[model samples]
Target: MSQEIRGHPQALIDAEKGTLDPLPGSLSHSKDVKPPPSDVLLSSKEKDALVTTTTQEVILSAKPTASSVPKSKRVVSRWTLWNLWFNTYRKFFTFTFGLNMIGLVLAASGHFPYGVKYSGTIVVANFNFAILMRNEVFGRFLYLFVNTCFAKWPPLWFRLGCTSVLQHLGGIHSGCALSGVIWLLFKVVNNFRKLNVTHDAVLVMGVITNLTVMISALSAFPWVRNTHHNVFERHHRFVGWLGLICTWVFVILGDTYDPVTRSWNLSGVDLIHHQDFWFTMGMTIFIALPWFFVREVPIDIELPSPKVAIIRFKRGMQQGLLGRISRSSIMEYHAFGIVSEGRHAKYHYMIAGVQGDFTRGLVQNPPKTIWTRELKFAGVSNTSTLYKRGIRICTGTGIGAALSTCLQSPDWYLIWIGSEQEKTFGPTISRLIHDNIEPERLTLWDSKARGGRPDTMKLLKEAYHYWDAEVVFITSNYIGNSEIMQGCKEAGIPCFGTLWDF
Candidate 1:
């Protein structure tokens, strides 16, 4: 009684100091103390406060250390010197070519005195003008509508109407008058060349003139200069080639000039006598020869090929100016590719739009499995065949269908969510997961997850960071809403999804 009483008093004192250790092997006294009954346990509020306090402690401990440093800036490459050299050489060649052409034009005309006087000035002006016009409003419009109706239509209509009005005014004979006027203008210009215009002098003048005009015109149209860079490049190339050809022709014609009259008289004696002219002509020929003889280098580029492709044809869409009920069809082609050293695979689609009767009403026919078989035949094997090629899939609705043929690919990390209607696809997905697919990689997002809607963007971002996804494949009947597409774009991710309408 004395020892028990003494121990009990010490234990009680130890408990008060929160240092009591229970005795071993007894329900009433053990090394590990049992938790109190539910009624005696801490209240919900107290439990929540304790959890909050613990979380705060953890966060404080995780704070950045004094030695931790901020991230450094990323460096990008710039080929400034190369670009400068390119621009300088390009401008020089372009200027020289233009000047040479104008000289030939002047020499072809017999007006030697006038041609000699203004040829150099005109070349400079023309060269500038050409450069300026490259970025002008009219030039941009022409470029954008090249090979289209816009370029062909308005000009044709205006010229036709003007011609008709002129014909009425001058009667049937007015056509002859118009022709005569044009011929006169041509003869006047040719007279300058006939009067012994120097080919070199004229060429120099023409190039300078073209560049001057081009620069001025382009300067006036700042918006065109800023926006249509591709258009400017094409125009520059075409103009350069045209100038080079014109220069060649001018040199040949200039060499045919008569020595006595100092004009392009085309007498046989003058051609034979002009050795200096021949040398110049040879130089022009040498420059022109390379352009015509150069061949296009062929390049082999591997492009994406679809397996189990799906096509959706939407009819009765309006198009063009005819108020016609235009038919539209969307061809969604899905395929799979292995990425990241066979550790991951991606499913992607190439969506194309087709219009008119040929593609119209095409969605009425049911999607056939023939496409899938064809892909298999064309050196693309299913998941059972090989590990590297990965799988191919296509999805559709109505007459539209989705097809997927697997290859020996790693299991994809798919966060699949669906309602009751999607039960039909459950078996197919299950089969995919069971066979060659990894369970941890698959995320099934059913209605039960977080009252539905489940912060898809947050989930996708997390997945992207954790899994390092290369491609995103989303299949849902809700293609009408554009939010999914918008989100994907915002995330800088490409999406493979079905399209019901154009």
Candidate 2:
């Protein structure tokens, strides 16, 4: 047999060293004999077989001996930690909050003239921006604009930066929301101090609005969101709606009533002329936009295993979108990554792993109809068009997020690491991968069959160089995401991982 094989060169080298054991269905190798190119197709005869075809995959059944173990010592320096700390998210937050702080200092020093009169305008302006940042319609438009204008035309660093910026727009949203609340507090206090011009009704509404906004913001704290999700959702959403109502009252009262005359002006023109009124209107429209798309849609649920539920929706979606579903229009809303072949396909799917109450309910009592918005939101993967070629690395359910990009675009490579992939995810997901993904562009590491997880960093580095990929997108749990991100940072490889803060 010739030493040169069509498969991954590293696999051939490992075989030559007698350090790797092939899985039962995989092609076996010996010192003097090399496997043929066609032999890379793993047999489908095995029980619960993981069907894969390709040369670049590593499917091992036995654990490597101590002497054969690959050394994957990660060295992260303080510089790398600092770079990670000052990420795109923090930068957006800092820039926005810093500008607000400067304005606040000016107002506190009494340098900003008419600070009391124009304070409402400032508050509403901040809120308008904050709401816009979170608006699904605006978000989709931004992603579409970026992908259309700069996809594969810009330099690698520039493209990576664009994706980072898109992913972290929530930072701007957070900073503006907190700043708006602070400005509202200042406005309310100043109105109370200026007793002559401020009407009592306006002051009361301001106070109530301030409290509602504060409560809504507090409910969104990470601890509250992670530990008591239902509480967070209710308080954040319902209280936010109450805040908006109070804000409308405050704006109308403040704009229409003349504090100097201690009387109300019922004229509609004066209310329409106020800057704060228009700003509030813009934000209200943004806040209510998604709700306009709300509908009760029929769904088909396939329960492959107790661990996961595959949900199929009517129309196919483009790659890199996420959909939020709920049992009712006002309750238990959860966001999941979407998997669709393309817009032309008959349907798009969401992989609902049994992670929480809503998802668990899907497996326990599947619903025939569910509440969802017609317009799905965009995610970082939506920026996949920016790169010429890239790698999508995900673990377990993360595959739900990572699979569509690879399926839709042949230039993208996929590396899915999981245990009992076919059995846990079922035929729907299995068929999608098998039918769309070519063997040369895939690496399915079944940790259950392999005895343990492979060195993922080593696998990623190998793929990054061999595939000549410009960027890497990772979707994994906290620890796995952290480890892979750290490795990528140290290697100076441009990459993006799942964002937990949002």
Q: Write down the TM-score of every candidate.
A: 0.24, 0.87
User: Candidate 2 lDDT (Cα, whole model)?
Assistant: 0.75
lDDT value, candidate 1, whole model: 0.28
Model 2: colliding residue pairs: none
Candidate 1: residue 305 lDDT (0-100):
17
TM-score of 2: 0.87
TM-score, candidate 1, is 0.24
lDDT of 2 by residue, 147-254 (tens): 999999877888888999998887787788888889899999888888777778888898999998888877776666667778777887788888888998999998
Question: Per-model C-alpha lDDT, please?
Answer: 0.28, 0.75
**Candidate 2: residue 18 Cα off by (Å):** 34
Error of 2 at 162 (Å): 1.0
Please, what are the lDDT tens digits per residue for candidate 1 over residues 223-289?
4322442333234334444443543344345456334665566676765565434433433343343
